[model samples]
Target: MDPSILSGMRGFGVATIPRWPWFVFLAGGMGCLACSSLSHLLACHSKDFNLFFWRLDYAGISLMIVCSFFAPIYYAFFCNPYSRLFYLASISLLGVLAIIALLAPSLSTPRFRPLRATLFLSMGFSGVIPAAHAVILYWGQPHIFVALGYELAMAILYATGAGFYVSRIPERWKPGAFDIAGQSHQIFHVFVVLGALAHSVATLVILDFRLRLPTCAD
Candidate 1:
């Protein structure tokens, strides 16, 4: 959001950056949200629906996490095909593994809430690898650091959300008071939305950086 952060990087005619990576992220976000909404809405209908939709919800979270990596990584590593491919493949594999792990009906229950949060948190934190790599590659670039700042905010928000989700606070602290409002899960969802917003800003920053100079030579 700060103009000065990107002031140093002069544009060499705006490059026509590919939009597929961005689209992938958007799709993932939408699908994850849809799955979560549906799960919450319909899971109470029946036991069978509960199992099916909750698993779907977990899988959708994995899908969104995996897709979130696309735009940032692809744009940051636009000049290096190998690193790009490796990161993308690694995340894809992790997502698949997470989905498989979460598909277990036992894991979806409140008893395994910690494990579920850990799995999702692990998937989210795995971005540190490529994020660090990008920082190193673009070291001293003001815009990159700004982007990193947004990412850091995203991480904090997500971690906080997960904490509430795992702890089940408010409601846990006072049994009947939070049943209708101020529940931990509701707070968790709020933080999730905030985290997603932060991530979006970071991604946009990276995309703008790449658009300024699409080619490595630039």
Candidate 2:
């Protein structure tokens, strides 16, 4: 691997910023997957376990959304310290809000599924401001466009996933017919993974662009 691709610590020449964004994402993803698997495997064990595990699963999803903002925003806005700080702060605040909102027992019920999906989608869509800023700030750079393209793709995929999640698609149409193979939830999970991978690629592209730019001290 290129050192530039992996060097997350040196944010715009600053060594103080920790390089755990990727790890944060990975941990979030793993936690989400683990929670989901456990929920499915053991929820049937009892009603209490079912409720608790499902809540854990929702928390894991919220965690993944929070972590997902780290890499792309960090790399794309690295050159503009104030912009970077603002975007990071905004997303962090949104993440906290999402967590708190989701944790409300009333909101966690099945009837509020649409509300939950909307909350998460809004958090993801909040990247638009930073993304637009990135493009405007780096208008002439090829990597900016490339990264933006990937980010756009990521957004679309995520939105589609949220649609599936909110609509409950095939499962809703055919009830127990899709209980095993073609459920909306399963499709939504696939899109979530794809969106994350797309974001990762975009982050790497932004990081490469940062590597080529002169340092802040220069």
Candidate 3:
């Protein structure tokens, strides 16, 4: 058992688990939202601004996907330092690669919308690896199972959002009716926000389970 894990355990009135993982996740979420808002707000300013802000928004999405791994991976592998480090490092590297791939201006074009969404969806779905591992690691724990359920929901929500993004639904059906409002892009953002909330609930559930454990040895 790691001494740090034991140290993080505390009695009432004190935090019972380390908070940095949650903070990392939250910061990533906020950064993504900010970039998204800026892209939507200023992309209309000019062609140059459009390209720049949209690219930043894509990069922010990658960052959030990477950071989303921290809380669950850290808590589930609390006493397994090597596994924790390996999973975290793997996701971080993948995120960097994703950002590098998206940096190509060619990928930002309308013709590549599906490609962009596919790249992001691939990054998001990669969570399945660590998620499956976590389930295997804590197979007997009901709370872990509950957390996994929420994670599954998050995955569905994100996939649905990506579908909306790539297919350009309702808006496509109505054409000019959705020009000013209710665009597919806007709907995609809403699903993303919902997905993030679902992920937050999963992380909190995992954190609570970890706190209740008397010791990492358990």
Candidate 4:
């Protein structure tokens, strides 16, 4: 469904909404999926392939996390460019640093799985500052709160997924029982997908709110 059409149906003003932020989120999502797909496909070919593709996968994950900040921050700060730039720049820097750390061969080892998980969680949590700011700015709007509820769900889902990824949940309990199926990594991936889906919903809700919410400049 086209967001513009949805907005029109919902009585959005006739002025064109800037869609570049939305597109940034979409591109990030597609890039993450594409990289993960390719990494899984090629990682088993050889040790070198495994190392390279896994690093790509990690970088892709970081990119997606960074991009997740764009639409929300862009729309939330639509009338406030300085704060917008600061938040975006901060997340971008963290994402780059995460990619570098995860790409390190030493850090890619099994022993560092917990560290990687912590890093990803930290990246997600970094949004807390900007999110609080947005709430302070838009707390009177019901839809903003509603959208934030969805984002909260997203955070929980992602956190649960990370927990599974790090603690090696069910498989950890039974080991070989889940060697081929119902594994921790597999479950982690599913949770991540669900989390992203929830995040997408939240992003759309925020976008819609921005289109409708009264501006302070008025």
Candidate 5:
């Protein structure tokens, strides 16, 4: 915590930071992974069911990505009220559009896999603008660099996953070789989980830094 805040707390303690953004992220993460696992497990039942569950999985992914934006954006722009509101509103609108497209049966099809991947990539990489802004605003803060390293790692992992998903890798190179193992889809899931872990670490770093400062001082 901020030395001033912590010292003040020593006499009259208070924890005033709102935690809704982080909580939303945790819920979204759980829902995304659960839906993905369930869809994979039950997709073999029938083609219709396969489509439905897969679409649900896509929706879950969208939810997680969108929710993940909240905490970072909130903490990053916390003191800059107008910027915070603008970023949040923009992402919320983009997320709505992304969810609508992902839930569409045609857009969710294998034939449109690249399109879906691009949409996700677009949403993810859009953070570049805000990250750049943050760096410019806090160039002397070492904690910002630490958090940025983790965020970059997340981006790489996620991009790798999207590549595997779009290319239908190892499986596509030798179809039957991966019949029971090493499917591109499985690899994609692995990378996504790894990416999320990286992001969570970054979030923790940022949270720790933010918690140490007075709320309106940044």
Candidate 6:
């Protein structure tokens, strides 16, 4: 066997996992957007509609958070089945808890806005654990650092969005000032979209990086 051929083989030994992360993110994003649009459009129709739509809207947020974990964890641990399974299971459980907590009748009230935001934010922040693990495992790789930076940016954007959603700022500052265009809720939505986009970018970067990492049997 040629030495160069052996070197080439070793260099290309990285594991390739399926692309289910992107699919999970796409589905979750669509679900959240659809629910949000429906809630906004029909909530004014009746009291029952208002209650139901709002609950769906909150549930949509929780669903998105859970789904957001799929890509990074799946790609980061592609060669490490144990870590991948553990992280996936942990996030799935968190998502279920978030959905149940948000769906609770009492927790859906306007008075519980901060509590709701806190729950979602906590779920999002949970990514830090897996992210930190990825860094520790791949500290020598530049792609891991790059992905971590993007993930951090996503977290900041999300936390900022939650702040706007919870505080009702700007709108509260000037009642009806933003009723038509720049309401805090609208701002929150924009930030949420931005955060999701950032997450997608990070996931893709991690996926590409994973493609270059060594495989399990290597």
Give the winner by lDDT.
1
For model 5, residues 21-115, the per-residue Cα lDDT tens digits are 88888998999999998998998899999999999898888888888888888877777888888888888889889999988998767888899
Task: List runs of model 4 lying over 4 Å from the truth.
Answer: 1-16, 214-218
1-218: candidate 1 lDDT, tens digit per residue: 25553444335434346779989998999998999999989999999999999899889888989999999999999888899999999999999999999998878888999999999999899999999999999998877998999999999999999999999898988899998899998898899888888989999999888876634673
Least well predicted 10-residue stretch by lDDT in candidate 4: 8-17
Tens-digit lDDT string for candidate 3 (58-118): 9989989999999989998887888999999989998999898787788888899988888
Output the worst ten-in-a-row residue range by lDDT, candidate 3: 7-16
Q: Distance (Å) between predicted and true CA of 62, model 1?
A: 1.3
List where candidate 1 sits over 4 angstroms from the true fold. 1-16
Which regions of candidate 2 deviate over 4 angstroms?
1-18
Clashing pairs in 6: none
Backbone clashes, each candidate: 0, 0, 0, 0, 2, 0
Per-residue error at 52 for model 1, in Å? 1.4
TM for every model, in the order presented, reads: 0.91, 0.87, 0.91, 0.91, 0.92, 0.91
Model 2 lDDT-worst window of ten: 9-18
Candidate 4: the clashing residue pairs are none
Clashing pairs in 2: none
List, residue by residue over 168-199, the lDDT tens digit for candidate 4.
Answer: 98988997999888999889889889988998
Residue 113 in model 4: shift from native, Å? 0.5
CA lDDT, every model vs. true structure: 0.88, 0.80, 0.87, 0.87, 0.86, 0.86
Candidate 6: tens digits of C-alpha lDDT, residues 106-196? 8778899999999889999988888889999988898888888888999999999999998999888989789889888899999999999
In the range 1-218, model 2's lDDT, one tens digit per residue, is 45665476465453443467667767877887887788778878988777777777777777787788777788776667788788878888887788777767677688999888888888888888888888887899999999989989998998999899999998888889998798998999999889988988887787667766656653
Q: Model 6 lDDT vs. the true structure?
A: 0.86
lDDT (Cα) of model 5:
0.86
